[model samples]
Target: MSEVSGPVRVAPREAWLLVATFLVAVAGLIYELIAATVSSYLLGDSVRQFSFVLGVFLSSMGAGAWVSRYVEEALPGFVWAQIGLGLIGGFLAPVLFFSYAWLGAVALPLFAMLVAVGVLSGMEIPLIARALKEIGAPEFRFENVLTADYIGALAASIAFPIVVIPFLGLMSASLAFGCLNLLVAGLSLWLFRARMRAVHWLAWALALLVSLAALWQSERLVSVVDASLFEDDVILSEATPYQQITITRFRDRVRLFLDHSIQFDTQDEYRYHESLVHPVLSLAPRAEKVLILGGGDGMALREVLKHDRVRAVTLVDLDPRVTELFATNPELVPLNRGAFADPRATVVNRDAWRFAEESTDSFDVILIDLPDPKNITLSKLYSREFYGVLTERLSADGLMVTQAGSPLFARQAFWSVARTMAATRNPIRPGAGLWTLPYHVYVPSFGDWGFVIAAPQQHRPRAPGLPRSLRYLTPDTWAAAQVFGSDIGPVEAEVNSIRDHALVGYYNEGWDTWFR
Candidate 1:
């Protein structure tokens, strides 16, 4: 008598249940991904955040399935489960962001919400399957429902990164998905109204109303809470495909942060940039062409342009929005000295490694001003393989300099750069027997920051002679930078590679001492 049998047709109402299953499945995974992404944004270590979030979520789901066995009447329980999931998952992003801003803590409330949603989500599938089986859908009911659930999850996973985060951002995207969950609940109630008794239609209606209201005002609410996360006024905040970029201002100073890590503080950025640019550029005085790997803020480019010999500069940065912001923003223009506006500078917004691999032209000086290798994505740039690629683009007398992070804080990580450069595979190119000159500068913003200058066959760089006007580095100061205290001296570190992320681990372990 059921649809899967000889001559029976599926009931329209029973068919809708499968559709509801798909929607619920989609909402469940979206909530999980949202939690993981938010955690990554706040916490520097993506590996730790995602591992913890997934482990906790799956455990809670198993508990939910175990508890579902006691529910004798599945319909009402299923309806309430959907409602609970909708309410919690819908508001998760806003709640997490606010908690991070106000309490400066997210582990407790984040896990609480994840557990609550996972339990409700876990209960949903079993209850739906049971209801379908009881409706006389035949033996194929289990297979049919499971297939729909998987398809829904696949759709959500693909759409989350491509459409949701890029356009609506985290807060609006979560609320929108929350509405989808509520709609599924409302649809289920309408379809099964005949079997219901004392269904709280009024309460359900009020919940839907509140969800819609919150969705309408999600942006404004998020903006208010987002402002609290930073000390200065947040002039611009955006979640791009690659990372979250925020620019803040306090009086005349502006600061740039990528994924919650400060790139540069405008107040003392000169000390950092001056040291990063001048040492390499001065050593290679005839350097006409410059390649900058990661200074999207244009601060390093500003210093690189100060030299009269620089003819053309190619800056390869992964994020276009960072370059766009620095190029156009009035507050940041003077800070970067309108470097992007110069005809000599060409901005290629793409991955540095990819650019290095594909670029045919060689440069006299290459400045690697990338972020610290705290995560795998950044660690790849600091690998021996990456240094090998850089060797291909260096001219006969060219020099490459990299910002090697804080020598005092991340000593092993600092030395790992020199280790990787020395391990470059192409050891026979002109000046191919690469040697790294390690040095450090005391920048008040980031104490005891280190840098490494790598050149072919050069034991020690011929002092390029400091620029006549520099805020931080002088000839005497540059020489003094080579001396390191016994406490912050180098430790044995492995050469980082695409296959092995030894430096990432070292960076995490080294920085943990300070952050923890």
Candidate 2:
């Protein structure tokens, strides 16, 4: 291989080839991201799915690069590789979704698609460099090709979360990029028409036709797969920067799902929101100002506002899209009782951990209504460090509560949250530790879910008087919630911290055991 010692002028043909390299790099990385994201949405663990997808992709790229050595004809190889990539990468998300919907597992298809796209991407730059050399263009160097590839990758990294997922969604984004790959292939075919045969032209045409068709039908494809995954009619579905927000309906019953995990089913959601908010507020010494983290739906906000004493409520949730939906959607507004419109309620779209860390105001009650710690990002919210941050924002006699996972299914995880909260050192009193009360309630939509209430000082939780309209938590049910059966009783578990993330492991294990 000849290395260019000085600046070299590139011809039109060589410039186009480099341009193809950039586009292919963009499409390749996007495909890898789509695979990882789709798997994360369908499966539980985000960290594991991304790690495995990246490993398979990079390894497959290496295999493709090594195999590229055998291709004596570089231009033809490059064209064919792009065509194959366009088809496989374009349909990857739809295929994975359908496979998961029908087969109940996407492991085989997901990894297989990753390998295919990775290997094809691996061949791109090498073949491009070889083609550039073969044409005898002015002092072509491999570094120039690499520079384009890396810059294209940077463009993809920025665009994916900011533009692609938010606007195009996973399935459509994959198909759109797939179309880009085919467009490159078509350009290459036309540029090197003399070098290409009738068969090559036919393949390019067929790939383009197929990719365009898929891109046009992306929404219908998504709906079909969603119908299989969800029991009810999917009335609303959108992928936000943070997670996939889906709303499904059956008759009058509506359900909200984030990343395929059910947030609430409207028919029995009052049972959950009531159980979560009332007990903590009832136990708190003062209920003047309250802070809620991660109840974007406003259901918890509805319950908090039910207390006439709560003068101000601040709700912090990461996704603005979720807050906007519940705030504006007519179907959803009735469920949360238009809590977002309340004068005393303030909705801040930001991470719960960061909000707790930065806020200077003290709250009489803090409610952590976040999703279960199924991944690292969420696990940190359940960490001792996070709880300690919240401790700083709690008034001296204040109380906080978090919705722990199901005690019946995720027994160890529920206990882990309780243990971690109990271990949190009270900032109000240097040597004194926090006090915690673990409890569970049975909601039909979700089975035996658990909650842990903590305070800087020891205080017995009592059911405060609530309105007659309150659905689930009566004094009797609140008393019954504290009584645990032996089967779902506390189990020994490690305290989850920012360093260890022990809770996520226990959460995954316990749920996996039950479902399996």
Error of 1 at 30 (Å): 1.2
Clashes (N, CA, C under 3 Å) per candidate: 1, 0
Query: Who wins the lDDT comparison?
Result: 2
Which candidate should be chosen as best, given TM-score against the real structure?
Answer: 2
Residue range 410-477, candidate 1, lDDT tens digits? 88998888888877765456444477888888988888999998877574465666667788888888
Give the distance in Å from residue 168's predicted Cα in candidate 1 to where it truly belongs. Answer: 1.6
| lDDT against the true structure, each candidate | 0.86, 0.92
Candidate 2: tens digits of C-alpha lDDT, residues 1-516:
998687666777989998998999999999999999999998878999899999999999999999999988999999999899999999999999999999998989999889999999999988998999899978677898999999999999999999999999999999999999999988998898889999998998998898898889999998998999999999999999899999999999999999999999988888899999998888887999999999999999999999988999999999999999999989899988899999999999998887888889999999999998999989999989999999999998999999999999999999999999999988877877689999899889889999999999988767667767896789999999999999999889999999999999999998889887
